[model samples]
Structure formats: C-alpha cells, structure tokens
Target: MKKLFHIGEYFQEKYSQPLQRIGIDLALGCPHRSNGGFGDGCIFCTEDGARARHLTRVGLNLVEQVACGIEYVKKRYGENVGLIAYFQSFTSTNAPVSRLRELYSLVLSQADFKVVIVSTRPDALPDEVLDYLEELNEKYELFVELGIQSACDRTLQEINRGHDFAAVKNACARLKKRNLKVAGHFILGLPGEDFNDWMYTADQAAALQLDAVKIHQLMVLKNTVLAQRCNQNSNYVKPLNEYDYAAALKSFLQRLPENTLLMRLMGDAPESELISPRWWMKKGQFLSFFKEYFYSDNTQNGNFVLTHTADGTPTLYHPRYRQHFHSLAGAGSEAEKKFAEPSALPERLQKSASEKRPLRLLDIGFGLGGNSFAALAHSEKVSGCALEITALEFDLRTLQAALNLYNPNSKEFNILQELINNGFCRCGNSEIKLLLDDARNTIRKLPEKSFDLLWLDAFSSDVNPELWSQHFFAECFRVMRNDGALLTYSSAPTVRGGLFKAGFTVGETPSFGRKRSGSIAFINMPQEGFVPLSEKEKHIIFDSTAGVPYSDCSLNAAPEKILSQHKKLVERLRRRGVPKWYREKTVKN
Candidate 1:
C-alpha cells in the first residue's frame, strides 16, 4: 500500500501532539451571494455556508465565537490537545484587509493555537489580501485552504460555482509564490460529473503539488439548491456508494505526492441537515475504515465479507490483502472481459473438443473461483468438451466463504466444497484439482508443459510482488505449454518486464473499468490477432527505471524482501541515469 501523509501525523512530528481543530465563522458572507456578483451562490451552498454547529448564538463577535469553539473542543477532547484556529464558512477573505486583520488577530491573542487555517474561494483572494496574509504568516504558522471543488470547467458552470479552473490555478500560483502553505478542498461526486472528471481534478491537484488536501464526497443538505434539483429530477445527482467512493479515493491517494498532508478524507454533517447520501460515519469509525482498507496487511486476519459488485454479483473482500476477490466494477464482467475472452478460453475449448481431449487451465490465486467459473460457463455454452482446472489458492477460508456466496451457478459452487474436503471434484463437465497453498510453492510442483491457459489473477503487484517476480514467472513459463497464453489484470511496468525476462512475448488486452490496459503474454510468437504493446507501454518497459523487475533466486522469498530488493535496484539504476531517456521522451512529447 502507498504511504499517506495525514495532518495528525504531521502535528505529532512537529508539535509532538494532535491538534483539535476549532472552526470559527466570521460571517464575512460570499461575494457570489451578494448583489454585485452572481446574486446566487453555488448550488450546494447552505444557509450558514457550513458554519460550526457549536457557535450557534446570533451576533457573536470574533472573540465570542473563538471562546465558544474553544470551550466546545476542550470539553470533548481534554485540555491537553493543541488547537488549530480554522477560519471556516462564508468566504473567509471576502471582507477588507483591515476587517480581516481584526478578525484574524482575535484567534492569535488566545495563545493556544499552534497553527491557523483560513478557508476561502479562489476568486476571493486578491493581491492585497495575499500580501496581508503573507505578512501575517511571517509571525505565525498560517495555511490558506482554497475551495477547488472540481477541475472541469463545465461542472463548475453546472453547479453555478461563479468561477473557473483558471481562477484556482492562478490563486494557487499566487499563494505558492508567497511561500504560504496551500491546501485544496475538493469534492467528489458533484452534479454533472463522472469518475473521469473526478480523476482529472485529482490529477490536476497532484500537479500543483500543494502542501495538503481535503477531499469530501458530495452530501446533499436540506435547503440547498442541489437538494431541490434532486427532488425535481432524480437523475440530477447520484451519490457514490462506499465501494465506488473508496475506489476513487484509492486512485486519488495514489496520485498525490507522498509528502502532501491529508487533512480530511470524508464529509461530515448533522443528520437533520443531510438530505441525501445518509451513510455518514463518525470520525473514529471513518478513520478505522480508512486504516483497515489502506494500511493493514491483514496477514493474521481471516475474516472475509461478501460484497456485491456493479454487475450485481456476489464477491468476497479480504481485509488482509486490502482488495476484493474481483473487480468492484463487476466481478463477473472482469472474469469474462479481462480473463476468459482475452485468453480465448471458449475458442480453445472448442479446439480441444474437436481433438477429443480436455482443455487444461491453471488458475493461480483462485479467490472465489470467478475466473474458472467464467471459463467453464463459456466452454459449456460452446461445446461439451471437459475443462480440466488446477486451482492454486493460499487461503481456504475464501473458498469456504464462496460456498455460501450467491452465484448464478449455485449448484456448481456448492460442489467446490468437495475440493476442500477431498482436494478434487467434478463440477458440471469440468475436472477440478485445488491446491491449497501459495502459488510460488504450488506452481513449482506442477509438471512442465502442462497448462494451456494460465490465469494470473492474483492481488496487485503492489501488495503481492512475490507472485509477479521474475523467478515465479520463470516457473510459470516452465509449466505453460509452447502455445499457451498467460493473462493478468496488472499493467505495471515491473510485471511486464518480469514476463519479458522470463522469456515470454508480452502484449496487451483491453482493460475493463480501468485506465491502463491489462497484460497478455505468450510463450511462443503471439498469434496474428494479438495487440502489440502501445507506444507508452513500450517506452515504460525499455526506457524508464520503473521497468526494473523484482528477482527472487529461490522463488520463495518473503514479499518484504522482494519489494526491498526491487526498490534498492531502482534507486541504483536511477543514480546511473537509466530513466533519462524516459524523461527526455516525455519532454519531447
């Protein structure tokens, strides 16, 4: 898993303790809501513009609001935690420099805050305001949080954002020029936006290389234009579920610079105020979920939970691997598109039937047996040829859990329990031999030139680098027939380079629900219909330091050892200017 930088971690390193954030709403108001600007604020703007709930009394001055917020935080979290004064709500810098100085100074006098953060619109920051904030930061730690909701200008117009992406770019440039820390506040699942649009926002945000970022899933609140629009047209807004939102966030987190601080990852609102997407969890629960899914190795944890994919099929998610047994987009769809069809399982089975022989298949990391079942289903429809499946799995708990999971072919799945009991079984017209062990150990025991189709559907190379190393690929190459094909969903340069090093002709397959294409390798010359590597993939494989493959001489080293060796090799190569060609290629393009 990629390392993420969190604000709590930052505070612990710098201040030696966590900081309890205090939200102070100055009631400066928004320019877009005023008569001089658009006269109507953003569609998602609420009545209070997200004011802190504790500061509820009307006509409270800056000092009073600060006092109320301090009392509220200190009561909830003991007095020992440090405080960070957050100027939240209603375009914090919309007022004049004189008024802003007076409001900002109130929090400075408290002498309890270690840092100050002010949230405002990108268009609200003028040169005069930037100069004043820079001056203020010279004496104290200050951060400017700009609301860069979406990178797509079209979505900005659809939401009546009253600004463009250019404004955000300009504001960040000005802030960075002053050496002030900038944190971007981005929202996913906005109206009239898709996953690609959200990724565009993340990519652009990463390009800016800001000091920190706060990401939130859009929550429709009562009395907001978004809620009314959703009421009028059901399709106006569709909230992301936990799985999809986590998938998007995973991509977002992977793209960010490792040093950038993650201030927030989820949205929060009072139950009474939320109008849609009611799956809000408390901060503790949310952080626990984040750590469990993104941080833990889960090697000792065997709990497997059933989850439904986009194609409405049951799949299992393992906490240890921090990945689902199948793709979240569609478990069954991935089995067909990325595995069966790409490998031509059906066509190969037909050829075997003509020769009066069973088609041989080797399923490595056969979690829930989706790939095998998909191939079997296709072969049954095409012909009556027997399909011989040798499945290698590391965890028996996943296989047991799959027995209770709902699938279209429940009867065939139920027969899989026989494999658990007897290590072999007959399911429909297929012969199944299950090897319950790690693939690295099990693949070596197989005979040479045995399998015709190999499904390398293991966890990602990031987590399971052992399975994708050159030594393991050499074992795969020995077991596979001369005319066989190996297919996997990973398109990482190291995986491809390992295949090449193992003496296989590598190609590509159309990816399913992902940006990068899947990989296809052949022991012999690839067939005429196979797609060659794209230009970008070719460059990565030959020119970049990223193409360096992991090596394990014994083919049974621990994942940590393999990853460490690969990282050291890459660093050594980098110092030798191995990636210079790739850098120059990118620049030329």
Candidate 2:
C-alpha cells in the first residue's frame, strides 16, 4: 500500500513538540512561458504566500531551502522534532523531471525532517514527476497541494489561472491513481464569483474525491493585478461580508466529504498588504464576528440555499421571511421576549440553587459571545459550579470581537476572557470554557458523549444547507450524552426531519419571546414522555417527497437534484397514507 502523508499531518509529526510551520520558496517559473505568464499570476497570488519577509528567508536550492526551514522550525519549536519543508513559492513542480528529482532528493536528505510537502499548480505535474514522487513516498512522507480556485471556468479565467478545468481534473486523476494524497486549495469571494460559485467549487472538490481541502477568502493584495483592477473600477472587486463568509464556510464544510481532512478554513493576509475589503484586513475581528453570529441558540443558514438559484445564482426566494425577521429583531419586543426567557434549561435545573454544580453546555455557533453571556446570566441564578461551555464559530473576526468585548475590569467579562485566554476557563465561582472555530469542523475534536446541553445556533437554513443536513445532525447525536438536549430556533419541518433522521427525538420547547410557536429541541435519546412518530409521521420518514437524501458538504452537487430526490421521497410518503397538514386544512376550509 502506498503511504500517504497530508501536509498538515507531516507538519504535526515534524513539529510534534510544538506548533510551527515554515514556508520555502521554490522560485520555479510557469511551464506556459519561459518568462512569467500573463496577468501577474492568479489574482489571489502574493509574493510571500502572505508571510512576513522578516520571518522568512530566500534560498537558492532545495538544500538551502530545507536548511532554512529547519532553522526556523528549530527556533520556534525548540528542536524536539524535525521540520516540515513546505515548497510554497510559485509552482514547485514546473521544472524538468530530472531537476524535480534532484530537488526532492536534496530535501529528503535531511533525515531529521518528518515530511516534505510540495505546493504546485495542477497543470504543472508530469508523468515522470509522478513516478519520482511515488519513489519519494517510500522514504519520506509526501503531500502535493494543488491550487484549484474554483470549479467554474469563467471564474477561473477571470482570475487568470492560465489552465482550464480539464487540467485540474486530469491532474487529480493522475495523483489519485498513484495513491498519492491530494490537497485541494479554494479561494472564496473571488472577483466575479459569489456564494453560488463557492458552493459549486466545494461540490466539485468533494466529487473529485480529494483527500483533503483548504479554503481561503479572496484577499485583494496591494501591487497585485486584482488590486489594480479594483483601483481602476471600484465595483470590480466584491468582498464578502463577515456574516456571508462565515455562512458560506459553514455551508461549504457541510458539503465536504466526511472523510476529507480540512487543512484550513481561512487564511491570513497582512493588513499592510491588503488594499480592498478593509473588513478582511481585520482577519481576527472578522473571524470573531462569524464565531459569535453562528454561536447563538437558534440560528442556521438554511435561507442561503433558498436564496440561491437552481443554477447557483443569487436570488430572492422569500422576501417575506427576511422582512419578518428583520422587523422582529428591530422591534426589540420580539428580541427581548426571545432572549429574556431561558428556553433550553432542563426542568430539574430550572429552580436549582446558585451554589449547585455549574451547567455543562455546548454552544454550536459561538458567534460573538452573546450566547455565552446569556448562558452566564442564567448560570448566575442557578449555581456557582463550572459552566463547562464549549462554543464553536467558523470566523476569526467574531472571535476577536468577543475577545475585545471581554472586559478585564468587569468581573463577568474578565472571567469569560480568562476562560478563552487560558484555553479553558474555570469561572471564579464556576467552570466555563469557550472552544473557538466552526462547530462541524470541531465536532469530532471534542470528547464523545460529553455535552449536557447543546446550542445549535447557526445561520438560517437557506444560507447553510450543509449544517442543517442529516450528516451534521448525526454527528451531533454522536457527541451528545444520552440525556443531553439540543436547542435551536429553527421551526422548519425539513430541519426537524433532518434532526429526526439523525436519531434525535424532536419536539418544540417554549419560545423565548412573544412568538406564538416555540423553538425546536432534540434529545440524544427520546425521553419517556416523548411522543413516537405517528404512523403518518413514520410514512414521512420513508416519504421520498417530504425529505431529500441529504447531500454531504460538496459544492459540486446540484441542489435541484437533491431537492428532486427529496420530492420523490415526499411523493412516496404521500402514497403511504401520510396526510398533508395543508391538505387537511384545505378540506376543512
């Protein structure tokens, strides 16, 4: 069997003693031309791969590069292990086969190193190079990172990638045939690309059977062609809003193949080098914003899918709900009602003493620390024990905002900050720690069957179909303790069906505010009083028309196809005596 080493795994093994990464520049030219090709390389390409010059040094050969990488790794990680030689600059494999072999051999000569990763363009790989890479696979771990910004050719050409879609497909096929591990790179929010394009790219990567994938938001760097274009026409560059980026990422991860390793969900660009989309320059703050927005109790991105056209273009599916929600939040009346009451609290703990054990909670979105604050407020009246909160958010800006809002002067804020800062925070009189980043990405990293209460607040279902899918819910089921409960504000029947499919016993809990209906709650295992699905409901389970076979997190799959499949299931259920609620009401009318 061929041994596969992921770039991340290689780095982890090499720097096992600590967290450190080194970027090595190959300085190889493009194959299309002896001189550099047109359009100044892809719009997103940067001179240093966005690394600081002072932090990195240039090397002429593979030996010097490896040595420089090693020196940096040692300095940062204290030499307990080896180094990960990252071939980052330009296309590492755009040279002759003989030259490629020689350079690879030089890097492998450093026996202390754990792995050597080559980041190259898909079109640059040749058969002879593959043979050499296979040979290197036997001695040292090898990972090939391929840049495939988007599956859409129009978007590809818009960025001047210089290769067609066929090139990426062919290269991936060749790499897979060799049993070599492949990592795909995608940039979200590129010029002329929107959420649909991003979803399509993710679906394509998933369909391509990639071993791993890394996603980066499009950053307009100073001195780049993209920046020049933006300067020429202010409207040429369209940057993603902080909310949009987080929602897009959440949906993207949901569609990703289950087994594929996500090397990165976002990347950092130096604020000084960034020219447009000033929001992205505040990478930390942007992430924090995403974290907080997604971490609330009842948010999911379901609406994103609804807003997208059958062909992946943005459209307004239902303007009424958007208006309704905005009005609700703006009125303050609904917001106060929804937030004033504690909806997900267990009956036993509803009236518990302040000295009781701290509530063990799991927060899915963790957007801006608002949910955490709410939890803290509820905990104050209940018990002094540890809150044991684990929150997940995909954006870095929201997390930074949370950190900033964490006041050292205020006792409550200080305690929250300390928990986040110390990796885990034990409240002065309680225990509560906040886990940062995307929930779906971070779910498996958590201790199995550990959470007592879970908050499933993400974007609306329209915005994030991946998070609302059956697979994500299944993972949620795996992580929750037997008696654990999950709470979310979504009242959509399809969302509830997904939770049911994931093995949770679902029902409605009291609403937070003046809404006539309550939010949804699911138990890891059904409670004694919980109602079993009626015969009609069971028919809905098998009713092809009612729900669709859930799509994994790949963006390439057509939503219409999935929805069609779901329609078929619903039709089957209808034939099986599943009475429609609307039909019944119509008959009465």
The clash numbers for all candidates, in the given order, read 1, 73
Residue 10 miss distance in model 2 (angstroms): 8.6
Tens-digit lDDT track for model 1 on 356-453?
88889999988888887787787678666989999999988877777767544775566567777998988678877999988888999999999998
Look at candidate 2 and tell me the lDDT of residue 98: 91
True-vs-predicted CA distance for residue 5, candidate 1, Å: 1.4
In lDDT terms, which candidate is top? 1
Candidate 1 residue pairs in clash (backbone atoms < 3 Å): 298-320
Tell me the lDDT of model 1 at 203: 89
In TM-score terms, which candidate is top? Answer: 1
10 residues in a row with least lDDT, candidate 1: 580-589
Name the 10 consecutive residues with the lowest summed lDDT in model 2: 317-326
